[model samples]
Target: MKTKATLLAFLLAAPLWCIAASSYPEQVFQPEIVIYFGDKIGLTDEQREFIVSEVTTAKDSAREDKYRLNVEMAKLRRLLDKTITGEEEAEKQIKRLFEVENALKMANLKLLIRVKNQLSVEQRKQLRELMKDFNPKKIGPSEEVEKRLQAKIEKLKKGMREMVEIGVNPENISKVTAKFQPLINAAKYKEAEEVLDQAIKMLDDPF
Candidate 1:
């Protein structure tokens, strides 16, 4: 009975584990982090321009890969739904899905690496110091803080909905909010606020 309970618990939590695993690794520096703290970090004009350019190019390039990934995922789901799938075909689809995901991951890593290379050691240190405040482990369970963050998230969601209603691309809004949800779920409220702020700014002035 205990073993069965453990197995059931694992099955129930599997999707959450997968989501946490697939999210941007905490150690990796997102371009939004640099952009948000640019003034405090004293980012040079050149550094800022390079980071933005690389991130923009990466997002554009990943669009096709993202589409392919979605299609592959759908194909795999359909295959799994069938009672007697061809093992070889199922394996091929899984491999293709992994390849697309890997390509997207590699492109993002390369972009971040280039951005990091552009920053001076002192600037990087400054960013690290600024980011310390958002570290989930360091934050206390303050009710006030939790309420504020939750309110901000709700407001942002409303704004995003409004944008979509006014013809803004829903996919663009979704891409930004995707990371935000996981952070919020993990009680990384400070980081979630930062992400939502940056997402709103990006959607408002996408150029």
Candidate 2:
């Protein structure tokens, strides 16, 4: 997820409800400003530079956090594949994922507050006007994405167990998982699930 960039952009124009991006706990997209707020709000060069510096830092931090989470999750998946880990370990990693996600969300709020503090009243009002057109409902499930992934993980655990008992082919399962990975990255969990389901059904057919 482009946490810092998404949050910084949201902070510039979105209102309080839209303040933190449905928040980092969810990895869904939302309705954000089409125009650049710094330009529209007529920010001075100094203010713009400050915003850029802070945003770059936050973006870097968020990227690092995301990288770590992906690494840990991959480790946990490997452990599970080898039967070296159990549900408790997987659950711990999931909790850690949520923790990092929450921290990123807070970081965004902090930056948003800092940027707001630096803005003049006129600038704030200009931002408000730019934000008035934002439509939150039109956005898909870009928020609470981790929550969805957690739930999906549980289902996957059950599915794996069922497959093992049925002597399902590992290659077949891998094919389905690989096919859906990109969809998940695109934040299309529903479509990913559909892909998995169709693949499984076709592969499991006795005919």
Candidate 3:
């Protein structure tokens, strides 16, 4: 009877322990990254081009304002850490920090608002579908699919680096989408799908 009770306890607890061990916080919020509208939408080729260009413009402008604010905040933090003996000086620094933080918050909000304005309802739904993470570990990456995905990822990284260096938005995300369309149409959709995933990840990268 004691042995039977022990076995029942082990059986009941094993699945619960497995689930607890695997559960983890998957969502992370990072403000500096540009989470693209394309990340959420199933864009028509034309829409992708227009949206990408619009977002790139908004983001570049936002980045300039954000950089200055960040510098000021860093200075304020340094001042706080120093040996400040006077209440007047401490109060001034605190005020400056709050002002800078508020400005940064507003700048980010404006950018998000602008991005939202550009997206249509259908596009928004598509974006949600695209942004979902595909866990290859659970889904099992086929060797052929993996190879194609890597190629697509490399291409996207190159394009992103070039955009940053040359200060040019890919005139249209449609161009990139069009470039992939043939491959997708040919039934090599895994590669194109994987490339689209890579593009979203690149846009999300903090740096």
- For model 2, the stretches where C-alpha displacement exceeds 4 angstroms are 1-35, 82-85, 134-207
lDDT of 3 by residue, 47-121 (tens): 445444555665686577556655655555555456543557756865664565555455545545555555676
lDDT of 2 by residue, 165-194 (tens): 888745665666686765543335677777
In candidate 1, list every pair of residues with a backbone clash: none
Q: Any residue pairs clashing in model 3, and if so which?
A: 40-126, 40-127, 40-128, 41-126, 41-127, 42-126
Top candidate on lDDT is: 1
Task: Name the top TM-score candidate.
Answer: 1
Q: Against the hidden reference, what TM-scores do the models get?
A: 0.54, 0.45, 0.40
| Count of backbone collisions in candidate 2 | 8
The TM-score obtained by model 3 is 0.40
Full-model lDDT for every candidate: 0.68, 0.57, 0.49
Worst lDDT run of 10 residues, candidate 1, spans 13-22
